[model samples]
Target chain A: MYHLISDIIRQSEENECVFWEIVQQADADERGVSKEESFETMRKMYQAMREADEHYDPKVRSASGMAGGAGQLLHEYNETGENICGDFVGKVMEKAIKMGESNACMHRIVAAPTAGSCGVIPAVFLVAEEMLHLSEDQMVEAMYVSAGIGSVIAENASLAGASGGCQAEIGSASAMAAGGLAYLQGGDAGQIADAAAFALKNMLGLACDPVGGLVEVPCIKRNVAGAVNALTSAQLAMAGIKSAIPADEVIDAMRRIGNEMPSNIKETSLGGLATSPTAQKRIV
Target chain B: MNIFDVVGPVMVGPSSSHTAGAVRIGYIARKLLAEQPRKVQINLYGSFLATGEGHGTKKAIVAGLLGMQTDDERIPMAFELAKQQGVDVSFGEANLKDAHPNTAQLILQGISGQTIEVVGQSVGGSRINIASIDGIETNFSGDYPTLVVHNQDGPGYVSAVSTLLTEQGINIAYMQLYRSNRGGDAVMVAECDQEVPQHVMERLKQVDGIGKVTYLGMMGDE
Candidate 1:
């Protein structure tokens, strides 16, 4: 029953189990269910995430008629031979856009932390599984790892854009995805925490200013950015780079920054890019 | 927090707080009414009022009142479905004080001429809080099998309800009682560890001074 990432790490080292196993066991104990039952629930969630990612229809526009076809456009661009990010990164970006666009179109999606930032973890996990040929069991374990990181952040900081900003929404999702990716690559618990810390630190004050108070404009593109950031952070952690500040302290800083933020920069759609003339013109 | 709170609650959504959570608030209000409402007045507040239409908050609420789950793909067509079902629905804005941004006040009139007024808030991430019932202040998250009993604020009502639940082996996880005035109308909100059987509800309704008994099983519990 660890409420903090630091505690989960310490307990993992003490029990001589990987981070996912520790999380699995702790989840069973907390919910008073068997470990097998807990794993079964995660399996269902993973299946849902996979279904959303695979069933993308880029032609479906948001109900607000704000975002549509961008995911299809990105996929087409990636199919061309002129892409610079290579096939692996391109695939990651494609899945992220698909997930975000799917959410905007009112398709079923797992709120990996939240719906506005739902694309980050699924994008990282699905792309990693395809490129690395990981099994279903491995993907499920990675979800457990991601859940552990998200629980800590949600307890220590805020995950709602209304309470914090985009830094709390997409920022937390990026951190969770980074840590999960590190675990899937066989990094230690400390390295996983480091990856999360780096990813969160990089997005400390990103504002939440969805144009027209809708989750379609900057929110969709931001999911793609979060996925890429998670991949980079995981790679750095695997290479033994350490964050100067610990993971828990980084979450505390996020909470502090969220508290200091003005409500306009939160989910109110009053400031930042939401106030730009281009964004304001679409309010009608 | 459990793993589901982090990685799950599969829902159809452009926004969880606005769409999914709105569905839950409406669903719970329907349950509290104990029947399908003949007419409903939904008052969206704060962020729900400012941006609800674009996010389909109204449709989500109507879908929930029709007993649809959060992930039901039929949500987008809920307004039309309500018309087919003969459910009169109207939307308006409310100035709720000190409530969460995503709040809705539902006024439902049931077929039996009984009315229920519920104030619910979508805190975030598909979680909801039933902030008040009628004019009485109360609090309970709709995560458990809950029983809300409206009765006269006289002696022995709480004991009577708790005693019946105990006889059925239902353990109360949390309980709160709120009243408008002394010896006047009161409500008891009990969240139980296990499901309260239909017989228990019928038995409670038969108790002296008990006006209405509402059982809201966990979301999707039906």
Candidate 2:
């Protein structure tokens, strides 16, 4: 009986390693592809984003954008008063905030299908496509890559903001975003994994700490950061840089870190923003 | 395991009880009817009634009737989409006794001249509990092979029904028997591991103390 248990444990560890190997080995742009094929893939992603964007309510969109510290910046960009990239960043932030607010209100909204990190993926990919004039298929391919990275994080670490804090929600989102960016930029699968791993590692130990236990407050602002971080990490990986730890190892570390984090720092909102003097004055 | 215990990875948003559960209740209510409802009236109770407007609870119900999931991006525009699909919907509020907070009662008139009253609650994370059908107070969670029998309350009604199930080689996983009074009205709900045979239902309906035997039927994909 003991042998059977030990065998099961060994198999589990081996499976985990194998999963990491698969991620570390994939390359979105490992080899030369026909120009037409590349274009088709880009087109598909753009199409999905557009379709998905239409499903998002304008009210929710506006809310997310405002809350992400992007409302004014986006408005400035719309009027050509801000740099293009800065404006884009602001818009992404705004959308993230709106998503948080909507979730707090218990709105029947689609998460793309993730409510907590809803703003990050769409804001990054959709905005990038518009700015760069990328095709839909390309964007969709990146999204698929992001999904793989997200699954790894979910399996090895946690996606529940309450479990690990905002780090899990926004950090995981950033990792997914980083993978998407690297994949889109023609990086190999290993590079994409490396980028994702690095991005998550950077933001490990961040707290949830949303004010008033609402998905608003820092939640919205963090999503914008998540998007930016994803893009940056992806760029780094495309440049052939690697994270200090492998993707799987980083995920395990995140899990351990989460386990050690105080419960107040998680989504319970008992610490950080929740306990801030200003927040206390407003709610209590 | 109870179906509720199994949380599948659907393409749905977060908060399965709030969003996904509400959609399922609407879907079940639609399926239970003979056809698509021409006119629908929904009454939200307690928390559902209080915050439903903001949560898109109203839209979700309409969307579910129109055959949409909570994860569907088009849930927000469900009202417009429903109109295009020719479904008329209205919403109201009700106070329910001994009911879950996030509960709604729907009165649907199908285009095929059929009508059904559906009362259900969205428990959380998009999960729902169906409370009753057509005034028959039942406790079936829309899982398993459910037998919902609307009958008069009298002696031997339960035993007679149990005997039929035993004879048919079907084991009841759980049973909830509710009635207003001993000699008044009653509803018998049976959750079974296997489907009940047609002959058994017929026998139960013919029993001396039985009034009406209606099988609420099976739920959809888990």
Candidate 3:
């Protein structure tokens, strides 16, 4: 029998999360501070998370919300030669539309380990790459580290919100992204692990309950959140703040919270914003 | 040495059940035909048939026939590319009994006038099993070098076959001997650590119980 766990970790490296961890370790060593020293790092990340939350001003002024078609934005940025952030975000959103367009795409789009969350890693990684001028090798390495962390969470906790809750879904994605970022930004394997655990722990008990089963609504928005959380966690870990709570303890909390959450808050589309009168009316 | 034991696949995905699974079904169908197909027909069954179109099932089938992996981003353009590569495609429906919901039947015709029928299912994450071929019951996952032989049930057939492999220095990773009954229809699936030699195949055909010998080679390796 094949060892599925080993295969998953190997594939995660093939996908580049492992090398990302290496970069983080290098940076952490350069700073002469352990990732554990950044114990209060998560609190600062929370503030960044709040700031990120406010950035999605999805209106006419907000390029993120333009309805004429966001698809053109990526191509437009690529043509205009602005920062790839605009181009990258546009690409992520375009992938989301393409994903919705065909069912047999078989992209295995990593969901909160979910399919929708697939873009989150790419989004944050792309941003980091552009900002830090990291090489493709570094990005690939980070992805492997991220994959390792994600696979562990998948094995020990749950990536499916239905199984554990949104905490597992988006939270897991955030954690994996954080681990990836931390690794890329110069944290050690242990610090990378801590950063990941901290990210997931902070977001534990998030609900799914997408207003529509369609991968729109909160799905796209959550991608933004996942990206921001990952970067924030990396920054905190690099700053030497460690999560006081153990990673395993946080996973347990996520599971317990998920169990306590009603099914409506899962993927059932029964509660939360999914059941709002406006959301019900908007159902296609 | 099951076919699934060796090969790992990469796939595109919203859901593996919906997307990657469909693509694997198509890829195997194309490979079974021996020649790149001129026209392909697919029948979706159960949940696969029901929600396939929504999940890009049709696109996946076309992509698979063109030898694309599930994770390959080219799946969306599979049809246009297949046309460029001189393959035609169509779809229909079929219901299989007690099968996984993600299942399909593919009937393919090569430019050489040869036809192949394949029944398969996508279990999850783009993994699939080739359930049957040409109304004959067969089980194959495209992971190994397999020789699927249909023969008459006779005494000492197993020993003869094993002896031949031993003589040839071929390691029999797995030998499954299946027979309908005594002196009746029988089939032996020999999955090997390496490809079986043509001489070995010829020797197996000369055995008393052997009737037909078809070397499937490696699944999906053109």
Candidate 4:
């Protein structure tokens, strides 16, 4: 029914349906499956994300030997009440890192938009589960919101770091998470679209230069930034802040910037943080 | 973009382009070969050459040749699997003009002694584009039911091939016919909205002036 965020919002308002409901019906129609079946497929994807977290092995190191244990360390820091970001944010950071680390360790992950940015969505889901006590069904509904936002980004811009830089990977994930989090908090479709726009604007032009072309370095840690950006953007939108740029315009700008970006900085690992002295030495 | 495309293709990963997409390229190569791979030569290019090893690109591609899916936990053990499965695999670098950085050219020999050259690129997010097959230029996402026909450049050939699909009630979503030079050699690439069944493909092989007929359906364990 809708491919653009503006269209989706307009459809939601005109039809007097919730954001996820429109997406649910549309996805069902597109996939040629029943609404229940379509929703169940999304539920299964959420289940995989949850299970990935449940199966986290703290001792597991990525093949490059640089990714491991930060999640556990953050968990310990949070338990001691030393985290300055507050409990909910700390929990999200922890979960985000865990998910990113798991992906780097060659474990399975839902590449929400893309794999390097996989942790952002699940971080929001797992943390919201802990702090908000939302039901599994509530969480899955939020995923449709994310998916709607994600599809728009993937279409107008791209979901690949190689094609669109880290902005497309982390920025798209953050925007999706922001929109979904807004939905989770009972925000209207307009608010959801605004939240996504705000989140993506904040992340536009971010580079995708992984050190040694590995996902373990700056790649995994960037997940926290994406998750927190989502959290803050959602909070801002829910509190009545409006994005100056429309969601579609923001996505269009993202595509242009991705095209303008030098390929060396777009996941080729030839520049940016990938070329830092410390990163070079740390490359395994 | 399907929302499902946004949500998943849940896969084994360190890098989607290098690892997961590589697996798909290999799987497509295996499918294009039409039988178990007997021996395969893989030529990695650009970024695939620079960073693919760190991302398990080699192992992932081998796993795919073994008919493994992207999420198969056995991906890391693809080398051992190849040894046991009797698929001789070798990797080398490639220099191709105007190719994507994440490209690989697989020259494969299948168990039935059929050989094919498949060049594919891992665009992103475990999605791949089959850029060419058997050195004939054609483009199709392995996601669709694709028919590639290599034939002599002549009249009635394109009509003949498309007519066969039309007769089978298949809709052609995209169709292209290219010739090396006027009346020299030609290729036809057709991506269908529905599967163009085995019997139709067998019939395609019978068309006059046709040198090769290849079909790619969908990715599955079988």
Candidate 5:
């Protein structure tokens, strides 16, 4: 029901509460569930996301043979104290790959918005568990923030690659993650809104070009980028940076741009990297 | 859109449109048959054919026919599962004119001699539409509790079905009716707010002019 992030923010301010409370109450109203029931549902979702990451099986390969041991490789690299990214981020990147690989291998995954972009929020939460020592309740609160932002994107733009391209899928995930990250770090509603806006605007017009029409190739790696992008946006917002355009306007732009995008790049796998010379050779 | 629609629908993945959505089409096809499927022929059209192999659309569909949910870990091994369950499954490329790229047609034969043909489209974000059932032009997304009623075209057929639903205290959310020709075969697609009970469906079948009443009550949780 919250079509704009500003709406959620305004409601939160008026109610003297955090963003998740506003979103959670709205969920309660929409579903006709009690507040406790709605939060319980969200808590179960967070648990499922965590479980998907914790139970990742690196031994299993995707049917296409493209994504399996990469998460293991990243994990080993993160442990060596030799990675280019920080230890926390390296671990986050590691989880992102594992979750997406689990998805490809047909293991259970919480498709936050969509299955292909499933890794971003879980990656952030996984790293938060090990590094920041967040509790289950705190993580569930952050999930509400992400869900709120994702709801807006789903309504205004899209969460399907076929509809708006990767910009809508991974792009929406990044924004949702950014808002959640901002919430976890105790940023105000404006900061959370700016973080989501910053993340989404950065990924505007990104294409959904998986090789051979599979959610591998660039798709798996894009989850990593989305997780990393969310982190950057959250950090910028906490540092008081604001998006030039409002968050709602950015989402509207995503809708217009997605409509303007051709079907080839919109998950048809006919163009973009899906048709690249090297990508063509790698198609399963 | 529901907030849950944004956050999660815990499922097996890769491509929601190709993989999870394919599983749903298979699941619905199984439900429509109203019995265990002894044999199923799944025909993929457009992108479902061009790249369905990589997406494991065949396996996903087979898993669905085997009564597996979208998040079932056995999805990758659906072919094996189908064989173990003694269900005959076959796949072929289809040319569904004017259908969406991610479409599948399933011809199902049940254990008790029941049969139904279903054409469904994976219309992105893991949602699907049962566009055709048994050569009849019907369109409905399985997002609600639904009833697919087959009846001879009569003045009171629609009222008869709605009256039964009304008797059960079930509110109708959406309804669509289709018939091949006037005064011939007709179908009424009713999506309800409450689950349509089995006895109500049985009673509907016994009603005058009504043929078969197939129901789909609630979706996505599984």
Candidate 6:
């Protein structure tokens, strides 16, 4: 219901709890649905996200035969026990890859802001849940935090690659995940906002150039990177780091950057890696 | 934009606007027809026409016409499923004037020889706008329990429909009326907060000057 992050923060201040304020806003916006019912719906979504990760079959290729097996490869690599990111972050990467690959294969996924960036939020939340021993209710509350941040981004900027760029898609998603992760780690509203701002600020100029006009190459791997970025940004916020710019201003910058982005790179598959020699050779 | 708009829409997709939204357009078309489509011609427009094949928009449309939800895993086999279900499907391109990039015009013929043409636009994030029905301009997103009432252009129809909905205990979330000329045919689209029951639809069809009443229940899951 609140169109701006500043508005959400103000309302949270009034309510004395960011999570409840977001849930109350969601309840009002849904028209007659109570907060509990809204949370129940979110819980179902969380369940679906978890199921998508657990049921991922890396062997299954996409219908276009452009993507598949990469998630399994990542899983195997993580299993070698040589990953420098450690088991927790390695698992986040693994789930992100699985979710992105699943989406390319037309598997059921929750569009955390969008389908192309679906993996980031789920990957981050699932890993946080396991690593921190957070309860399902806590994860659901964290999703409310993510939803509030994402709605602000959607209203102020764009979430579609065609309209903005990968910056809006994956970048907004990483911000959402980062904010949610900060909340899960018991960060205050200011810290959560900082996490989101930091995550988005780092990804401002990212392009959306899916090779072959498919959400396969670069899209899947980009999701993995977004997940890690969310994790790192959350850790930074939890450690009392602040973004030089406010969260709302960072989102405004994202909107301006998205508006100035050339059409060729904004999901046209006509620029960036989409036009690379290797991608060009495989285009036919 | 609600929380679900951000965190959910649980869908099967390579792309939400291309695949999930395309399926929704076809699904809404089928519901408006109120029966299984015997023959359907889908006309893709702009970006949909340029990249729909790779995104499986064609298959998604067929799947939607067959009553498949957005998350249905059978989408890849939509063509085979349509063949098995005896639904004839064809595709082409359309030059829609002043329409969104992701638009599709579906011409469907029901088994009883009833035909309906729907021009719909998938406006990203699996959200859609049903722009026109049977060439008449009207707008309603398939997000609610919608009633599309075609009637003679007059004063009493809106009040009458409103009364009927009130009697049925259904609250109208939004209502819009459009007509070509006075006393000519008019379309009134009413999106209700509650689902319009079949009995209410039957009663609305019997209203004087009301030509056609089509009720599209809440679109099941994204």
- Which candidate's lDDT is highest? 1
Candidate 6's displacement at residue A39, Å, is 1.7
Q: Candidate 6, after superposition: displacement of residue A284 in Å? A: 3.1
Q: What is candidate 4's TM-score for chain A? A: 0.97
DockQ pick, better of 1 and 3: 1
Model 1, B1-222: lDDT tens digits are: 877988878999888988999999989898888787899999989889889988889999989998888989899899999999899999898767878778899999987787988999988788899998886887998888999999999999989998999899999999999999999999999999998889999999999899888889864534
Score candidate 6 by lDDT.
0.89
Per-prediction DockQ comes to 0.80, 0.13, 0.22, 0.67, 0.80, 0.68
By DockQ rank, best first, the candidates go 1, 5, 6, 4, 3, 2
TM-score of each: 0.96, 0.59, 0.67, 0.93, 0.96, 0.92
Flag the better candidate by DockQ, 2 or 3.
3
| Residue B83 of model 3, lDDT score | 82
Per residue, candidate 6 scores C-alpha lDDT tens digits across A121-181 of 9999998999999999999889888988888898889888887899999999999999999
Off by over 4 Å in 3: A1-68, A71-115, A157-171, A202-221, A249-284, B1-13, B71-74, B80-88, B109-116, B133-140, B153-161, B164-168, B174-186, B197-221
- What are the per-residue Cα lDDT tens digits for candidate 6 across B113-178? 888899999987898999998788888898889999999999899999999899989999999998
lDDT of 2 by residue, A119-171 (tens): 67777777777767777656756665565566556656777776777777788
User: Which stretches of model 1 miss by more than 4 angstroms?
Assistant: B95-99, B111-114, B219-222
Candidate 3 share of real interface contacts:
0.25
Predicted model with the maximum TM-score: 5
Model 4 segments more than 4 A misplaced:
A79-81, A244-249, A252-263, B181-185
Total backbone collisions, model 6: 0
* Each model's total of backbone clashes: 0, 43, 48, 0, 0, 0
lDDT of 5 by residue, A1-284 (tens): 57799999988888899899999998899989999999899998988998898898869888778778889888888888998888878887988888888887778899987899999999987687668777888898999999999998888888989889999999999999999999888899999999999999999999998888888878888889999999999999999998899999999999999999999999888998989999878764
